[model samples]
Target: MNALLDLDQLRTFIAIAETGSFTKAAEQVNKTQSAVSMQMRRLEERVGQTIFVRDGRQSRVTDTGLRLLDYARRMLSLNAETIAAFSSDAMSGKVRLGLPDDYAPRLLPTVLASFATTHPNIEIEVVCEQSSCIHRRIQDGRLDLGIVTHGNRTQERNGRIIRSEPLLWVSSAHHSVHCQATIPLALGTKTCTWRAAATEALSKAGKKYRIAYVSSSAAAHTGAVMAGLAISVLPESALTSDMRVLGEREGFPEMKHCDIALLRSENARDRIHNALAAHIVNALDNVSGGAALAAE
Candidate 1:
């Protein structure tokens, strides 16, 4: 008999699939391209199935590869948990975190759960507000860390970008607000990046639009769009299954990609903050469909 799938090989396989290029995967895993290729070949042999289809400069994961990817992710997650659980540095302290209402629901639960499991002694306090509010809280030293959206045009930089997704025009699947002569828009307050990007794009396209509804809450924006009151611009990650995306064919202008970043206060130098930040980054990377950018 032979050993089961190697953890290193599985990690490499995931990196390749996530990065979409052997060269990129090599860079990520700190291996030479030839070494990455050797690992893939060895993994394919161990599984007794063809994992990827290679052509010229491209490689596509096969159906078998997709199936293996699921198992690989699970294995790696468990492996990470085991390592974190036994690490000598047991973290304990109160960490205050803030996030935009739109992203909190989608990302906070999983990130907090993972952190809690690994650091049982740590206490986490979360505040969900508008991104602008979160930024201010961090600046005021009212929060230890924050996850906020950075506008494409904002010259002031404060954090590492962990995720980037396209800003999209979304409407109710059952409504035709997009077809209206003057587009009705549901937007957040003036400080919201999505609102600014949406209006700027519309204005540049010479399209006429009116703000039909304004709310700082993500729920309000979603509800307005779902009720056929207006279309709203949102990050692709924030969109729900029930929403329909409007594109150029629907007479909507293209908007810039929204960059979600992590900011830590200058005073947050404790082990708890570092542990929680790592967990948040890993959790987001897992859900970001391999589009999660390396923190910079």
Candidate 2:
């Protein structure tokens, strides 16, 4: 007979992969380090596959582990949903959620609506800010959860990657601004990862550019781009019909992929928090090639 895959072991495995530290995973799952290791060993035995390999001091997930992750998440989500549907005790509490305005327009509707329908008793307080601000709030215990852009090393250390998208050089479809001798740019504040990527790409390509507008708001970037004031770098989802992507043929270098991640506060361990986070992961994980004018 085939061995059964235990839900509890899969839960521990997820914590380890997301936290990227055995000790941290142990803490998150309420298990001792030795117990966590023992559970992983049993999990490997059941599956007959090596899922983890040591990298320096960290245990990195193997390719097989990565393949298993999607199924694990789906299974856990369904299990939680099923339990919540029939449980005598319904979950209720306030969850402080944070994310940039860029994502709010697109991601907020779906995630909020779904969560509200299933966990009606729960209240959610949302904060819209830049990725840096969201990370600070998560670390400071002011926010229960955050969906943030992956760029800062400090933030990435504790972040669980949820999605990735291409970063493209975008210009107004009706404008020839990208062909200017000194390219005009509309970008986020100096601290923004997208801005850093855009400037670095231009500098490396030996292209001259000027910062024409600076704002942390995606709407502001849209305004600048639509008015033929400047070109900007945005995630593929953030592009609108009025915008066209620029590339190497247009003298723009290819930018790096943008990673979106979920960050949870240390104090958020209750059932309500877990439910909301899981709901968010499930909702966002299924979004692919969605056409939206939202930002990171």
Candidate 3:
């Protein structure tokens, strides 16, 4: 029996689904439109039915195309696996992992220590940056994996989402700002997920505010906040004796938590990648769970 499809045809189908046009898919895949059309034809012939339903400008996937997308992802993933399995070398190579800044306070050291114990030969490099930077590094293959924030992961290469937890407002114990005046605020740069969440919530609530302290580092933000000059937002686990959550400051916005993802490349089907993902997931779950217990 002839194989039902080739890798090239499956990839063309995914491009069509994503781009919604044979012409666009052809350009994206660097094939002629006729070639793309012929590939779809051959694919349909193998499956014994049509895979796409064309209506004017839009090309919607038929029931078959949708099912085939899942297969395509799995196929491509395994294809990647087959290449990596043979290509993988001694695990002595370093693993470059990216992380978000705020998450580092409680999560980073634990994860690194555990991974070190498991893969002592493999050196680890940690780069702490914003969530967007982490995602870009993961996509560009600069970071083998990352503990990124609020990233939307797809089935094939979207990476694994590990934790989602609420971040709360943190202020010095002596905060006296009322609901009427501008509240002194401490926040990281504009690209920060937690900072954006807090500012957007404040804008929606029409709360008067001013950035009393802006810092490049989370430690700096915490310092200004602890000095009783500004208030900052952080994960609840970041609490300290000098800092506490504001209870009566009124008009807390409904910012639904942040997602912290344990992401790796689609190419990370190697044993090293699998081991790292497992260890990181367990560490993050324990960290979040243990923090929740402490908060309670």
Please give the clash total of every predicted structure, in order.
0, 1, 1
TM-score of 1: 0.70
Q: What clash pairs does model 3 have? A: 154-158
Worst 10 residues of 2 by lDDT: 287-296
**TM-score, candidate number 3:** 0.61
lDDT per residue (tens digit) for residues 160-188 in model 2: 98888899999999989999999999999
Superposition error at 118 for model 3 (Å): 2.7
RMSD of 1: 5.2
TM-score-best of 2 and 3: 2
The most accurate candidate by TM-score is: 1
* Winning candidate number (lDDT): 2
How far out, in Å, is residue 38 in model 1? 17
| Order of quality (lDDT) | 2, 1, 3
Question: Weakest 10 consecutive residues, lDDT, candidate 1?
Answer: 287-296
Q: TM-score of every model? A: 0.70, 0.68, 0.61
Compared with the true structure, what per-residue lDDT tens digits does model 3 show for residues 91-162?
556677788767786766556654553455566788988767777888888888888766333422465667
